[model samples]
Target chain A: MRFQKLKRFSCFVFYSIFKTKMVKKLASKNNKIELGLLENSSFKALLNSKYQFSKKIVIVDENTQELCWPFLLTTFEELKEAEVIVLPTGEENKVMEVCFQVWGAFTNYQVQRNDLIINLGGGVVTDMGGFIASVFKRGVDFINIPTTLLAMVDASVGGKTGINLDVHKNQLGVFSNPELTICDASFLATLPEKEMISGKAEIIKHALINSRSFFDELTQYLEGVPNDEILAKAIQIKADIVDQDFREQGERKKLNFGHTIGHSIEGLLLHNKIEVTHGECVAWGMLVEAYISHEVATLPKNELQEIEQLIRGQYETLAINDTIFDSLIQLMKHDKKNNSDKINFTLLQKIGLAKINYQLEEDVILRALNHVFGQ
Target chain B: MRFQKLKRFSCFVFYSIFKTKMVKKLASKNNKIELGLLENSSFKALLNSKYQFSKKIVIVDENTQELCWPFLLTTFEELKEAEVIVLPTGEENKVMEVCFQVWGAFTNYQVQRNDLIINLGGGVVTDMGGFIASVFKRGVDFINIPTTLLAMVDASVGGKTGINLDVHKNQLGVFSNPELTICDASFLATLPEKEMISGKAEIIKHALINSRSFFDELTQYLEGVPNDEILAKAIQIKADIVDQDFREQGERKKLNFGHTIGHSIEGLLLHNKIEVTHGECVAWGMLVEAYISHEVATLPKNELQEIEQLIRGQYETLAINDTIFDSLIQLMKHDKKNNSDKINFTLLQKIGLAKINYQLEEDVILRALNHVFGQ
Candidate 1:
């Protein structure tokens, strides 16, 4: 009892020091991205005030339930009455059956449209949880507290929520925005080193697509997780693109520069039960696409080599080459961006600019895979 | 070969008589409602013209697949090559499992984002198919060809697309508008007499909430399905309310006058495997709510008696008793329109006006149910 009281007292002290007076908020047309200390958030005022929310349902994975939930629960008085829905960790659990179960639980809890759902976990938790909240009673208001680096810089910004259908990634989804997203750096302490590195791949992709300076900065900070500045820049790049094209009908395709190949490779490996982070697959996917860009698109050979070396030095490449190419191409053809029989690619024109709607041939893609994987 | 050619020639002659020059198009900000003859609509110029659609995917139920799909397939050259996804008839199959199977079919068929989905059946087909299209690839363009009178008047207009979660009606869904809603009165010939009467409940609700003249007109024509004028007026009432509040944050609750009590009774009866159409339950639900409105919300006793007489004359009340009131109230509390433990109801102030956000006590609701069902 003494120890518990001490912890609560310390939390109150910490909260008072880092109060919301010095808050950092990024605005997109769809939602607000609150990036700073959790104590210095607008959440405290919103949750503890004259809010009309009937209930608080917090969705967390096994990891976040243990590592992150306590900090917020201790800080906010309103959360004392919150019901927690803990999800199983990892991408493998991101499927429709899991979503259905969570939805059934929501019904059991009598979750209403006026209730606030707080997604307090990594990518799978946020993505699948967001999907669950969005579909339940035709979407309730949700606050995403992204716990992992990958979710903070990438998944946190876009209003994309989905769960995989079989081997296909994000086969079923809806574009539903959350009410607010809070990216607290304190949660990074709970993430594994591998998970942190895995998230950095999206940061690299953001820099590759939009800013040469951000790419240069990413090269210097290779040893550890990205800081607040890096997370903000990466998130801003995504938010800017999404705001301009919320539906991905036009300019937003630029953000999918590495994702087309990344999803195919990731889907293939995950289906076969081979362990690989999404960031690792994306790092390699970028290398393969860079090679293709140099050969076909206007990307210079030296720049392609620079990208290949950067990714090769950072991420350990996957095994198997010639045999996987056919299946890989088949998976790529199933990509959501495609409108025809041909695979749609977003390739780099240069270091900081991307070209969308590139319908490259199968043989060309295979040759690039051979060059990247066969190495 | 001669018969086939003769049928094609007849189809062309029929289409020519009701050409595109005289299209009856009602415009909403979200979607266009193409009323009257389908041949007089813009679908021809869109499909046969310089449109970029790679494929056409038509979603139909068993009933419409046999009766309606052939009509469209023969009329439009584009639909000749269109693929069909046939669902089973009735509300029992409106679940996640069906959506999952349909999504897998979509994957196998390589249905892309730019591809068009044509929903060609009654409420089940349009509601479930719209959801399938909306979620797959984060929404694809779909056209709703509402076959049954219920779907043409109610489901086709509001941009509400969803499937039932267990016995609960439309528990999982999104608010996604269709590209076009083609309401061809010709398909009414395929509907059973029971189904036509089932759809009249909504038209009656529309009249009660909006106009007295329309209600009087409805009283005179109590024989078969509603004509085009009634269809247009019923659709317009729903469309106008939806346009003002698409997300149902405010004024749109007026449309939910009968739904609160209706869904509860429908859910209870459906779960128990008692045969009932949605329209029948809704008719009785209106009677119960009208009784409650008269008791507490300034609705005239004469108006309540009139509504009771009209509904009692039309729909045979379900076998619900006082014992069922507790469970029915439980279901009403689970309604999506509700924000708290109190049941949310839209009560009638007069014959042509509704008051929304009436969170009434359980005793009042029980009294109303006792009055309606005890007789």
Candidate 2:
């Protein structure tokens, strides 16, 4: 037993180091969607050297238009001529209706295929802008300048661009990479504490799925906010996984460790017209899913307790009763990740190890939810 | 001068033969999207060997549901258990509302990612179905069983899938290819003569852009209907162009020879509630664009006359007055093909030799329109 434990520990260490090295290598080589530290000179150089857009359009929400747009315009002088298109703030506006209005705006402005659209906001702006650019005249080139921490580390790093359909998150979308993703951490300075915590949920997810050391490092920032280095590392981890599987055909699905249940809870809340940040729901989801991982995938008890405690301490546990469990399960079955009637999940085998395409029985799921709710 | 003419003739012969050989080689090697005859044995064999769909859904219009779906069911035993989704026939129904309904149907049927959606109708069905499949759960594999000549020769062969936005035709769409496109000339038996003529416009455009000999062959079918061989060759011509430039960056713009003015006229008619076929507009477009080719690109007057005469002989000329010209030019300026303010055109330097991204003066275009109108 001692030898077996030692062998497992060695394997984990080797795998973690190898993964970190691989991610660093990929981050250096990745030119398809460059995730760069937002600097005026670099941004100007990128636009002049790479893109030859006839016209530039900036898409932002009301919040970003007020908070981030001024700073962005000042930082990038090339954007002075760019037309500003403002959308309403929040996830509720991330729908087909908003896309229709945005498409109409493009038509009104006569946005050509060669012109560039700069998405300057959080997940909603980037996701909707990417979708708009992708479908407009079959496609147009666009760059994402994520102003929110959640978007910078997770949403904007991945090429998965989409808008919500009805209540389902990212139900209507395309796998289209941006020309560039400028991750300016300075934008996070003005973000609310809730928003910071929301972003941290994804960062925590990245660490739990890929690196135990990273998770330990993240725990240090649990009482505070993460620095630029930590944020860049999380982004690099996601970029590496995406590089391996852009379409989520294999290893990329590990990113969805918390998203499946998280999305369900988010969708249910959205459908009910309840206001909740994406990260809080994901925090709740990780707690419950971690429990399932412990029971089904043999996740170590100590690690499970640690994960549960960390997530629960950050976010309030949602009251998942029998009725809510039934609805949540129904939402899970409707997930795009599922095959036929089976609900596939990305479960944790242990900290820093993820098992993708894991299927569990309905009773087990219900029991997990019951445990999460302290039933 | 005589020696120069002889040399030109030799070059034409050599180029024509080489192009044909190249196209044939490409056709044989293209495994991503197979183009085959829709015989019972071949269709049955294709389904069995190539795809392993759990559930099959047949997307058809009311017109094709009656005319073609029964024939399709008899041809493939695998489609015996397929669900029928009947959409309303016509270009008017190609919108987001219909797509919303179709997506709802997919959800209701629990259509999985691995399941198949066989588009078994004309351009509207194939185009709309392809769009639906591409967007549903990011994408689902689909096959095109084009029931109309327009669809078989043009729409089904290319990966361009779209639905119209309000009055703008194909305003919202994606460049997503189908798994296979089965072109059964047998479906042409039930097609009306007008629809056959409409399909011939694209074939004529294909010939004008690629081969003079093919144009000569097409003229023979102007007085009468074409056979399966002629239809297959037209499809092959389009397929070759699409294979080279799937995104319309360079060589593929040649395919839009008559479409600039053609789409404008079609859009205007649709907007004004004046019903006109896509082929008739394209036929008129060919006459005007051919005139432009003669004036700007130094196309031989004799060759230009030949094109105008042949097209005018088959389709009746639509009366274009000064009032319509303004709207037509305005629409042309808004074309997705245009870069900035310039109205870009694909003019012909000579027959079987298309010059893409050619710009013509406004007066020249107006003169060409006047000439076509016999003003």
Candidate 3:
């Protein structure tokens, strides 16, 4: 027992030293870069030390404000005095009108440049709130306390914040990073099962591109893991990718795995006011697009089958006619991709490997759609 | 005649060498950190160079969309294909609804990440348009083509963009600078005289704080030089100050000059839906606040007279009552300068100097109000 205790103590010390060196290296790499993600097994200490904000932080949504404040009140202890802005919830509220309300709150609260805004909801809250702070007084610091799984894995990490313009999604925005993100998975417990599934899609994308082992681990543990562990690992996957590509200048585009078609589908569904979660539509999108990759780009039939099988296993497949598929393709063309006119896809060469310019043929997309809808 | 030519050549050569050295030194200083300013300059060049975007850009406003689009089309030489997203004029249209419409145009036109949003109109268009760009797909670059005097002087510079909430001014926002701000004084020729007064107020504020010579020059030339050179210099004053404190950390607060009460009064006037322009209300706010500064801080009687004489000489002053004054003071407390309970003022020590922590007793404010009211 004495020998074991001594060995554990030495291991702990060594681990601490290793972590310090790693964090210092990371800090150096991301100097003057606000939008950054930190990933590691034991990053709790480093996170706690880094985010030292004063008392005037504002939480920008009603549901998230209620759910997140008490814990943040305890964690940042100093943040107990922070004002809660609490605008209405959902994508409908992610409008320029809501941004006005947020700006008013900062003025009403006399938010200073050094002050912080804590965005404590899903993508809408994180994106809009971060955008508000970014332009509020030029730009004030903000932290993302993301609740939903999608935000934890995708929205919260990147510095993409903005409201929708016209019928488009994220048609207006700047790439501005928050000062820190305190993502405690406890927030995920309050999320709906559908939301969890939506988040898992992004996690699955990450695993496919970066770690086959992680994919296996996810497949194994996804059945019935504790919420805390699931959330932690999911966030860890996103953080790892973000750390590698702080901006979407390179590998970060891979993280948009399902998003290309996902966003187009989202815009279409939103315009129609159809009842569909962002993730659900994106899941279907990934499945169909993956089929496109298989048929057009000559991706191995085995890889294509696996992709379809996994997506079908995870989500409820939706049937679409040619009209819908054509409209979807048109939407993709309108995407930030197709600079002049070339359909770009961030596709997997194999599990754990991805490339951005792997163009798929039009016939392949049609075939994939047929496969998905049983035409 | 020969001597004159020789002298001119020598002067030109000396100026060229000096200009080279100055550019090198300025480049070095600005290389570390600095600011850029321009008057009615072509943003097309800067934004195109920065992001390698297409030269064809579109400017949008209800009125200008009709008037300016022709010129923009001719300039970019893409009238055949360039897309324009026009929205209604006025502060009411500066909402999320309009932002959506703008993004819709962007998506429909297949606008890329490197695409530009040229804000054409007053502060409303610049603020909302910039806010839209700041948040779209994370963010896209933007340029301010301020068609109103108010936008050219204050709104276009300092990278401040936001939309207003109900009964609040600039409630939602992010502080993101445009790649270039094209502030053409020729645009001012189209502006109503009321808007010109607003621009003059900001120029006066700039002169009051930093440059006595510029202040003197403006006092002499306020009604004379409504041209590019003066407009460029006014923009330069703001740009230089913003470069010193882009985030409004310390010295930048002095730029508030009269904006503390000025903004509140503007909000009040806007709430009441009065005919007063923004600058007119700020002029009154400055008068009241200056009187308060004189009474409380012993702001040298002669200098106080000069302030009163300067504003009174240039602009019309309304007979504000005690009740109105009392309410205005209450609004001032809600200003960002107030820390919890204490109201802070960026009071003028003399014509060219500002002191931020000029705490005044309540009774003194009352006395100043009475003096301004001519009670």
Candidate 4:
């Protein structure tokens, strides 16, 4: 009887492995957009067969150059002729001056429209590189090889590309899609614990907006990199939303659930010269917005408590003073997502459902903030 | 019998006037892109009926603000709340700095995505304004109310919006269409003789590229502004070509017959601080490219001579020395149209036939330049 139980366990493990391989293969082949797992042999084959660029330029941030580019160079022989353009690391570098420098590099190289720009870094590299390619000689084709988990699940999947204007986040940009996106989970292994926590916020966001089961699964794996199945599910959720609304005209706004307040916080911190990861701000934002959701969006009190508990357990709670509250509200007023001076938000109706364009009163917003700060 | 003859003549004149008005009305109503004559009631109706903006902003250059804005304000009551954004007059200001300033103005004004941007000047205003609106907050709706004949027939018609990178013309840009374009012939009355000649070159180009009969008709009306019928026909011809190939990937390239060499010359002259109008460089380009066509693409010798005579009669032939020749050739090499470092020329097979992506040898190009210079 013990031998039979051991055999059943072995079979289950074999089936799981086979299923993952099949899913990866299918992802590289069929999707609304061409999303490929880079480690998949089929993705490598597609790159070798389809793309015959005259020149290939790989744009990498300092961190990515040290951590990601060596693996990329060794895996793809086509990149032997690829020129490496190293940009400085951090969100601070995601500005117009950096774009100007990158554009100048493209001009110097005489990069043609048919040439390939491989954006190999986190969100900053992908966003900036995508914008540069979209404007250079009207438009050029580019591929996103996102090395960070935040990029793989969030930035690289969405066609949105931009750079900050002074202190404003994503103040200047265009809607331009990359030719292909390769999201390899192996890069997550080398990520620092802080970076991992930052990436986890987006994964948690995907779950909170789409599926309760996915949320439970993700929270269980919060201590380390979630398995390929969980990552793919998170990515697919984002891709489905982005595919429905590339311009964020309607359904796409739901993806900005935590982002409204998150961007304000992120922008404020950046402007104040306080270093903070996007995910950390977003994690805090989700917590605050969840409270707002409970009041205005029919989000249940129990679910809100669970969300707050999960987020608070993972991330350090922000110290929100009256001064910071005033500034945050002021920043929210200037958000690009808001129309006609009315602050619009995407709030969770429940654990798995989100409602967009919710206009909340100032008092309610303040009340929500007070609740978040335990005032 | 004499009374009857006079009655018939009056009837014929009345019918012609009615038909022109009817055509103008139809153009504003039913077209792939709305092409409206600015003074017509239909254009005013469109502004009143379709576009309801909370705020209206007019973008004009120093020259246009002085000459055009007052007339626009007086004509349309909808523009009572309109703010004027005056840029410096000249192609020199069509750079990133100007774009930055325009973006800053839009941000300061808190320009919403639905707000109207009226580009009320020449190609420079339309190009820069369109690009700024397109990139600002992903995109905002804008209208082109072209004051110059050059802008009406060419720049404002196509969705190609861009600004120059230093001396290079249209080095950075995006493909974005304006919501509406209003072309008023009355503005031509106030245009300087030099500016009028500049606008005439694009009209001449349309005739040369598409219709021999139109070419003959345009040459007859060379001294001043052509009748509304002739202007509309020129505008229609360009609109048809642009609609056929919006991206310039294939058939649309034929429209760039003179622009390849024209841009090189324009860029070189601009770099050297020689103030040459775009039309003047294009006029010279049509001459040299026509010679190249005769040698390479079997363009009839008689047709080439006719082109040369018409252009030469209208404008002074550019004196191309060996010094300028080298620079022009160097500029041509760096043209965005070229592939694999080969200089591509769009050569005319005949007066009404243009072939694109025709690779030319260096010696052939040199010979063509020498022939133009009468070396």
The numbered model that scores best in TM-score is: 1
Q: How many Å off is the CA of B128 in candidate 2?
A: 1.5
Cα distance off (Å), candidate 2, residue A222: 2.3
Per-residue lDDT of B306 in model 3: 73
lDDT of 3 by residue, B264-357 (tens): 6677666666656677766766776777667665567887787788788877765356667666676766555554445566777767777666
Interface RMSD of the candidates, in order:
0.6, 1.1, 3.3, 1.2
Q: Which candidate has the top score in DockQ?
A: 1
How much is the lDDT of residue A176 in candidate 1?
A: 85
Report the C-alpha lDDT of model 3 over A300-324, residue by residue, as the tens digit.
7787777777888888865456668
Report clash pairs, candidate 4. none
* The 10-residue segment with the lowest total lDDT in model 2 chain B: B17-26
Q: Rank the candidates by DockQ, best first.
A: 1, 2, 4, 3
Q: For candidate 2, write residues A230-251 as lDDT tens digits.
A: 8778988898888888888889
Indicate the docking level reached by candidate 2: medium
Candidate 4 per-residue lDDT over residues B1-375, each given as its tens digit:
343334334533543453543425324221333333355535566567666545688899998787777776766788878889998988889999998988888878877666778898999999988888888877887888787878878889878899888666888889988877777665555567888898888998888788888988887888866667777888888888877888888787887888888998889888888888989999888888999999999899999999989888988766466667878877777677876577888888888778889988788888888887754
Give the per-residue lDDT of model 1 (tens digit) for B1-375.
344445445544543444523456775776688877677777777776534466888999988877777778777887777889999888989999999999999999998898888899999999999999999989988989998888988987888999999878899999999988988776676678878988899999999999988888988987765666777788888888888999999888998988899999999998998989989988999999999899878899988888888999998868899988899998987889998888899999999899899989999998999899985
lDDT tens per residue, model 2, B1-375 = 343334334533543433322212227233244333455224566577655456888999998887777766765688898999999988888999899898888888877777889999999999999999988877888888887878878888779999987667788899988877777555666677888888889889989998999999888876544665576678788888888888899898998999988988888888887767788888889888999999889789999999988898888767566678878888887788998676899988888989898876678888888888755
- Clashing pairs in model 2? none
